[model samples]
Target: MNLCMIGTGYVGLVSGVCFSDLGNQVVCVDKDKDKINLLNKGRVPIYEPGLDEMLKRNFKFGRISFSTDINKAIESSDIIFICVGTPTSKKNNSADLTHVYRVANDIKKNIKKFKIIVTKSTVPVTTGDKIEKIIAKKVNKKKFEIVSNPEFLREGEAIRDFIYPDRIVIGTQNKKVNRVLKNLYEPLVNKGAKYLNTSRRAAELIKYASNAFLATKITYINEISNLCEKIGVNVEDISIGMGLDKRIGTRFLRAGPAYGGSCFPKDTKAIAIIADQYKSNLSIIKSTIKSNENRRNLFKKRTFQIMKNKIKNKTITFLGVTFKANTDDMRESMCLKMIPVFLKKGAKLRYYDPSGKKKEINKKVKFCKNIQEACLKTDLIIIHTEWNEFKSLDFKNLVKKNNFKIYDMRNIYSSAKMKQKKINYFSVGR
Candidate 1:
């Protein structure tokens, strides 16, 4: 199958590459000419593990290609996937579908063949209908079927998620579209994959509900972590015991500073607003959003409490600045919020992450070249994100240069080892 993937952001790029790797001819379209040039020049715009190698392999096989020419890509493909961004609106909790709409309008103007226009981006319910209406008004109505096929890939491990997802959801009323989508993903399903076929609206809601529910799980654990801290209990042990039950499977139960990334925070807000628009109050999801915000603030307080009388005029080093490890994405990272508090308290700070070369951190604090540089001569070391390297760092050597008052926010270090080092190690809820 030939697939035209619109937008080369996280979802689009990974999906395009994966589909191409599956032996489908793929032309990934992006509005950014610079990004397309980079891709064509064998450069990946995003820092995903093993992506460049896969791109090279697929590009060598002539199964994958890159382009800024949307019309050309659209005209040549039978399936056009609108994998553009539906980022949260600034003014409200609604999703800003400007990019989706623009792509729809453009597709309507150019395409002549019967195409399956799949909504691969996470969108609100009934957005497929809205997209269908827009395409109908501009093009021949018989030429396309808008299928809501929302992606469920997580950042940092997107390639793995894409290759082996929990399920493939296709939403459409047309039987033909269903059959075509089934065939499109037949390779994966044959290799033991699950499929959920539902109405377009239901499929859309499934995406939002899944993300919101995961956010709620994290928030639930975070809320419990707070109580555990107050009551003098190990939340990690409690969570582990609770997760052993068949009913409460272990996932997203790790207590951390908060869940802040490109998805959870925004999707929870958008869905809560969606429920509101439908006159259905989602109290739990609304609280989940509030819980996440409260957790971040609580974490900030906890950091300060650990640094009581010690943070004043001290050099602090942050281990990871990205929201999660493996990706350089720093949208709404807890460190972004926590760093200012330290700066306000008159602390010299330096941070390091493999992918933490973000503009936000560059403007605010010193960007260290490596972990050792960030830790050098710093009084306190804060591990914000559980980057793989942090777990296996030469801690004995790290503390040799400094007093090593550590705040392991993600609980990456064991309490026994911290005591062995005679270090003051503060973790979440323990």
Candidate 2:
């Protein structure tokens, strides 16, 4: 299969590389000349595990290529994947579809032969229909089929998620389009990956619904953890007890500051806005958004309380600043919110992350060179993201230098062990 993937962002770049590795000739097109040049040199702009190596291998094998020519890409492929970004609109909190729409217009001008346009971006319900109408305005209806094929790749583990997806949802009413997509994903389909065919609207809604439900689950457990803390019950045991059940299998049950990522924060807000536009109410989702916001402040308050409200002149180090582990994405990260608060409170701050970009970090915060430097001479240590390096730190050495006050936001440490070292420890819900 020959595929044209537009917008070489996280989803586009990862999917194009993976699909090319599966023996499909993929042309990844982006308007950014600098990014295209970088990819052509066997370098990727983003930090995804194993992506740079895989991209190089596929490019070397002549199975994949990068280009700035959208017209040429669309002309050469039978299937075009719109993997553009639909970031949250700042004006109304709805999904900003400007990029998606712009791609549609580009396709309208360049599309010639019969093609199947798949929306690999997370979009609202009926977006496929809108794209179809936009294309039909210029091209004949018989020349194309709009398919909603939303991606469910997690940032840190995107390659694994793409290669071994639990299920692939193909949203199209056209039987021909369904069969074509099945053939395109035949490699995974043969590996026992379930390919579910549903209406386009359902597929679009499935992406948002799944994200919103997961965000709600995280918020639910965070709230439960708070109650457990007040009542002096260990939330870890509660999480384990609940996870052992068949119905409530534990996944997002581990509580923390809150759910903050590119997907959850933006998608939850987009869905709530979508519900309101439809004259419907998603009260639980609305509350989840509010609860997440409140949790950030609570995290700050908890840190102050741990320091006996004497944050001024305190030296603190944040172990990880990214939203979650395994990726360098800082969008909606708790550290983004908490860092300013700490600085305002007159606390000297140091931060370190294995994958976070130095350019994305705030100028006010001191970026540490390594774990030893970050942990040394700090009044307190806070673990934001559960990065693997932070899980097995030399706590004894850290405690010997610092005040021995540690806040494990991700619960990556054993409280019993911290206590054995005579360190004051604080963790979420435990």
- TM-score per prediction, in order, is 0.97, 0.98
Model 2 over residues 1-430: C-alpha lDDT tens digits? 9999999989999999999999999999999999999999999898799998999899999999999999999999999999988999979899999999999999999877899999999999989999999999999999999999999999989999999998999999999889989998989988888999999999999999999999999999999999999999889999899999979989888989888888999999999999999999999999999999999999989998999989898988999888899888888899888888888999999998898546766788899888888888788999999989898888768646645689999999888887887788999897
Model 1 Cα displacement at 138 (Å)? Answer: 1.9
lDDT string for model 1 (259-322, tens) is 8888888899999999999999999999998888887888888777777856778888889898
So what's the TM-score on candidate 1?
A: 0.97
Model 1 has a clash total of 0
Q: In candidate 1, which residue pairs get closer than 3 Å at backbone N, Cα or C atoms, i.e. clash?
A: none
Task: Give each model's whole-structure lDDT.
Answer: 0.89, 0.92
Which window of 10 residues has the lowest lDDT sum in candidate 1? 395-404
Q: Pick the candidate with the highest lDDT.
A: 2
Off by over 4 Å in 2: 399-402
Off by over 4 Å in 1: none
